[model samples]
Target: MKLSQLGEFGLIKNARDIFKSLNENIVVGIGDDCAAIKLRKGFLLIATTDALVEGIHFKLDYIQPYQLGIKSININLSDIAAMGGIPLHALLSIAVPPNISVNFMDDFFKGVKDGAKRFKVSIIGGNVSSSKNEFSINMAILGEVKKKYMLLRKGAKAGDKIFVTGYLGDSAAGLEILKRSQKSEVRSQKKRKLIKRHLMPIPRLEEGRFLAVKKLATSMTDISDGLASDIRRICEESDVGANIFTKNIPISKELKDFTSSQLKTRGTHPADGSSKLITSLNFALYGGEDYELLFTAKPENVKKLKELWKNVNIPITMIGEITKKGINLVNIDGKAIPLTKEGYNHFKG
Candidate 1:
């Protein structure tokens, strides 16, 4: 059946299928009046709101209303999670066009519900309207974290080791493929890595909480705005400079394997011993929306984090150190580099 016939309910029902991908803490108000969450600790409540717009935040064709629905909420959840907070509640508001079907709205809410469920959070309330000609969503999320665990973008310090979770640059590559869809680029290995990373980014809520619990972070920021921007945030907040090494940055093996095979078969150089794939190391460093964590830790906790990486399989790479002074994204080979905030910033474009 076409989406026009499905109406809102049918769309919502369909989006429920991807709920398994988000947090598991949702209790009440999924299909009911306001999500009823039984916060285990009931600490001081913290909240945040973020918007995802049709043309600005995402394109409708690349991401369905359902996926956009889930993603819009998830990114906000990630913000709180970055602060080491447990998400509790959210209020969603949407603006839609007259031509849009009820099914699109339903699918959108279903995504909203499922995403909230992933964080064990809920939609306590929200508004819906049809006077606009575009799709827009805003979710205000509520959560709790210990006062001590409340991480601020300004808490990092000099002498702390700079670390980032997961790999980088996949999302940028993905965007490239998505835009170049008409050219039929046979899905390069590295390109797929970026695409997949961009499409289905997982918010590191649990891992972030774990970091806070262990008192492992001195300063932290996620790579949503790109490694350079987030690192710049931490450094500026701490009144320090950073020196990230090019050698240590982690690019995904999936990217390497895929790209290598594709290139080798086609007689092209997949990666010529240098690790960067789609964009250069500089691009990955500055390219935004990776959503992985970038944090600083005391020297002692840095050691502990290294050991922990093996157990959880969460790679914590030390790209550099918080220094006394300039955001120096340098090379071990003795080159002083000037860095740019190359990641996703609305004003930059």
Candidate 2:
């Protein structure tokens, strides 16, 4: 049935039934005017909000309502993770055309409920409204962290080592493949993995929490906007420079395979493979939505951090170091090139 048939209250009733909460802290939940919660004592609350709009953030042809639901929640959870906080409650708001089906909304809400449950968060409240032609989703997440364990973007210092969890560029590469593939189904395992990276990025919550609890990270943020753009945020906030080694940046094997295949298909000579390298590197450097943790730590604690990082499944890699001045990438041939912010910018035309 279409949403217009359900009416606003009926649509809201559907949401309330799906997201009903059982936590003692949630004194007021979905049916109430405002969801009220008891904050944990001795912890500071951290809140973050994010939005996704059709055409701009995603296309109906490229993503399902279920994946969209989870993606919406995961992106917000990433912000909480960046500060080493535990996500507790969420407020979801969505606007869709009246013609949208109630079944579509059901699957989407199911996705949201599953995603939030995985992190022990309650979907306490939200708003739903009709849109003219587009579909939009917005979420506000509330989390808490001890004051001593909270990390931020401004604590990095000169000579601190920069590190990231998991592989980069896969998401960007996956997105490119999706655009090129269009409606045709992608069958290759490598391609599928890349596409999944783009569609369902895993937030580095465990790694972020470990670094914060152990007092290891000097500064941290999630890689939502690509390294080239996000590293500038750390630099601006911390008042430091950075030197990233081209050789040290982590690239997934799938990405390397894809780039190699592209060059071979184009009959490019091995000696002229600079274009191939640049293509892959560009994805890693400027392709956003990786959702991995990018953090800095004191040089002295590098050994300890590495030794303790064995507990997490995601591998941590050091790619660069904070510097006294200038943000540059040290190329394979030892040339220092100034880095630019070329990642996704909502306002960029």
TM-score of each model, paired residue for residue: 0.81, 0.95
State the lDDT of candidate 1 residue by residue for 1-349, as single tens digits: 5444664455444434433233356654435556555665647778788887777767877876677777878788888878888887787776666577666666776777777777776565566555455777788888899888878778767788888888876665465457647544576565666676776677888878888887888877777877877888887778888888888888776545544443423221112212343434544675567788888888877778777667665677788888888888678786878676555566645
What are the candidates' C-alpha RMSDs? Answer: 5.9, 3.6
lDDT of each: 0.70, 0.88
lDDT of 2: 0.88
**lDDT at 7, model 1:** 48
Over 1-349, each residue of candidate 2 has an lDDT whose tens digit, in order, gives 9999999999999999999888999998988789889987899999999999999778888888999898999999999999998899999999989999999999999989989999998999989989999999999999999999999999999999999989988887887777767676746999999989988777777788999999999999999989898899999999999999999999999999987787634321111112344367878888878999999999999999999988889998999999998999999998999997667777762
Can you give the lDDT of residue 83 in candidate 2? 91
Instruction: Return the lDDT, model 1, position 283.
Output: 40
- Compute the lDDT for candidate 1: 0.70
